[model samples]
Target: MEKPRTIPSVFTPQWLPLGSLVLLLVTLALALTGCAAEKKWQYLPATRGEERSIYVIAHGWHAGIALPAEELGDELGFVREYLRPGRYYEFGWGEAEFYQADKITPAIFLKAVFWKNPSVMHVFSMPAEPAQQFPGADMVELKLSATGVKHLKDSLRTSFKLDAAHRPHPLKGGAHGEYRFFTAQGYYLITHTCNTWTAKVLASGGVPMDTVFTLRSGGVMRQAKDARKEYLKLRPDRAEQEGMQ
Candidate 1:
């Protein structure tokens, strides 16, 4: 019988297919690299004019003051009788309340005012809560002016004195210190307190630390869709860092 013919080995002609496989991988890698290098939007800092406009829009009257209920009644003729004392001790008046607080006194009444043109508008007082009991409240006024708000913002950028970041500290009478800035309608409000817990809440909520600051800072008479765009631009790098975390 004739000897069986021998078959060639599978590896004998491997380079042709191997070369094609390698080329495919290299092409794929280049495509992926191009995708990775795609362009992304860059954040631009707000210009002076833009900053001024933002300040104006954010400065409207949205102020609040906490005062003894009785004292509020004495000062404002009509107390916010509808409010429940313990349940709703918070108050909101005008933009002036955005910044200034002379001192902290328990049982003190807070009076807040707002004005686009101070002469044209009626000054408003903080409303009362039903559950609160201010037997012998004193009056405390929180004032905000355009110049003052700008000064406060500048102070924040330069010095840490304003407590705008909501840092916590202890006070003499078992109280905690905190502050916040907030805006509503076409107004801004600032609030200060020895109550540390309250401060944290306000700061986390992005509220103004002082109503006076809010009024001086300025704001748009009407809300804008891109109002928060600057704030986002302020920390563009944060998103990438957060994603890595």
Candidate 2:
């Protein structure tokens, strides 16, 4: 019989096999953990001369949809009652703990990160005057048509939990100034984060967003900025160019 073929010395070394196994596990772990990089919010280069426009505003650590309440309410009846004679509204979704908690603690953070925490949609009515400037809030105007608005309204309607009457379930004693909280339809988790939800909503409204990479507010704002740039390029004009600055 032919002599038994001996394995290569490199593979036969005592530590070589163990080292290879460890290397494989390390590489797998790194691959699994690698995720999209985080970024800071920035203003979009675009104009605000569009007949009617919507905005996605990035708060310090959160993101919200800002739009004409009248138009949105017209499409989603639940919001009609809360439109409150205001022309615009900013809606934000977040984990109930971070949203409703008067004080933050370790437990709340843990629950928000890992637990299936209840979510809340906060509505803030915006009126025209000295334009309310939310500190550190970066706003991006979205270029959308009437049809796109309808789709956005539909997406917003689905984000809330409806009552028997198909209206948003308003949280009692939740109203604060022009803001209030409502029962949201989804649960908050690491993967289904607030920013991720915002991305999904924007996509439904015909805005081009990379939902997969948008796990943070920065990612959402970055995509919005890119879309705004493209929009301005397509509709260049003197007034629009001024707004781009």
Candidate 3:
């Protein structure tokens, strides 16, 4: 005689964790869809040639854009005061208090996600050779054409909410005074999170990214790496020129 084992019911206590995980994922998906439903301007492909290298850096829950200090345009003059000529500038935007917090607690994270709060741009000034700065961190190097560079700089320029003097004022030192926070436009939202911002910035820079559901650092970095690959395919010669090999 043979007996068949009955399947466990999903309502059982043992399945509660699995059910909860599915519910969480569904809720996040719905939230991302609702928040990203806003209209976005379609971008044309970047122009051929005149490529410049930029980086997408991942710091666990956060992501940032890193570029040559020379690309720091006049519009973001405030960011220059923190670094010298031979430096790399990395920018990230997020909820002011939560982003600057040295240690994140459950309560702080909950408030940042559930509440609407002012945003701040955190600029990290690293050595010109940023390769070693974030040694253990995930980084992707992407090339942007002239048109893409312009779009990227424009995004950076417009992120700051200038004071009455028409300039972003530095707020305070962040991350053990290694970086500085500056006043920025827009509010940090659960759906339009820091990772979302990173994806949007890359999209503006002619990276083929769908910013809608890019609400996590891993996804943002993954898209950036893919974009780099696509850019290289269009101009394999430039990869050699840039010493990316």
Candidate 4:
């Protein structure tokens, strides 16, 4: 009698083959890139009366730091003498042409996305609070300690391309007189975008940031909110006990 042949089970586990592994990696890469493309904002301590606040603001697809104009100018040294008396100063880093362009064109978009252009740092002196300065904009406010302020100042200092005299290399044209442009330290690319620059500043300021894989503003803001919440939870009396020194 002939013995019956049995069919192999289809549910058996198979090794993650090379093709599958590669596909997984590619998927993860794409997902990460997409996430990075979105805008984000965040801040520490939280807004309070009279105490200075550092605001991370989102202007459409762009991100920037809205700092107290006086403190920033004083601490940064580079901008100290240049900054006019203002309530706040907004700083943004991006491709020169794209940043200054009246509107985004195909050429500007292509160059900015592909990292085919040099970068610029835009400094806007505001006579009002950031929210008042840029109405209808998205913002995250953080109340930082003196140490945090120093970290932010140091970070801003390094982001500039200064001359031998330690002055920023200014661009001739900008949004306006109060709004000036300077040479930036790095090239702008999809991987290292404006939001990514903001994230670096926040991380340098001692605000916890997942800098390694964070390429989006949303990511930075998310981490900032989480950190802020955790801090407040740990010290429920933070507001009452600590002064904004």
| Clash counts for the predictions, in order | 49, 0, 0, 5
lDDT of 1 by residue, 9-55 (tens): 11011233445554653354334321111222122233322221112
Q: Model 4: per-residue lDDT, tens digit, 107-150?
A: 55557665557888877767777766666665777767666777
Q: Taking the tens digit of each residue's C-alpha lDDT, what string does model 2 give over 84-121?
A: 55557777788876676655555665566658888988
Which residue pairs overlap in candidate 2's backbone? Answer: none
Q: How does each model score on lDDT? A: 0.25, 0.64, 0.69, 0.63
Off by over 4 Å in 4: 1-30, 33-52, 73-75, 80-83, 172-176, 239-245
Q: How well does candidate 4 match the true structure in TM-score terms?
A: 0.72
The TM-score that candidate 1 achieves is 0.17
TM-score of each: 0.17, 0.72, 0.77, 0.72
TM-score of 2: 0.72
Model 1 has an lDDT value of 0.25
lDDT of 3 at 105: 55
- When 1 and 3 are scored with TM-score, the better candidate is 3
Least well predicted 10-residue stretch by lDDT in candidate 1: 117-126
Off by over 4 Å in 1: 1-150, 153-227, 241-245
Candidate 3: segments with Cα more than 4 A from true spot: 1-49, 83-86, 174-177, 238-244
Model 4: which ten-residue window has the lowest total lDDT? 4-13
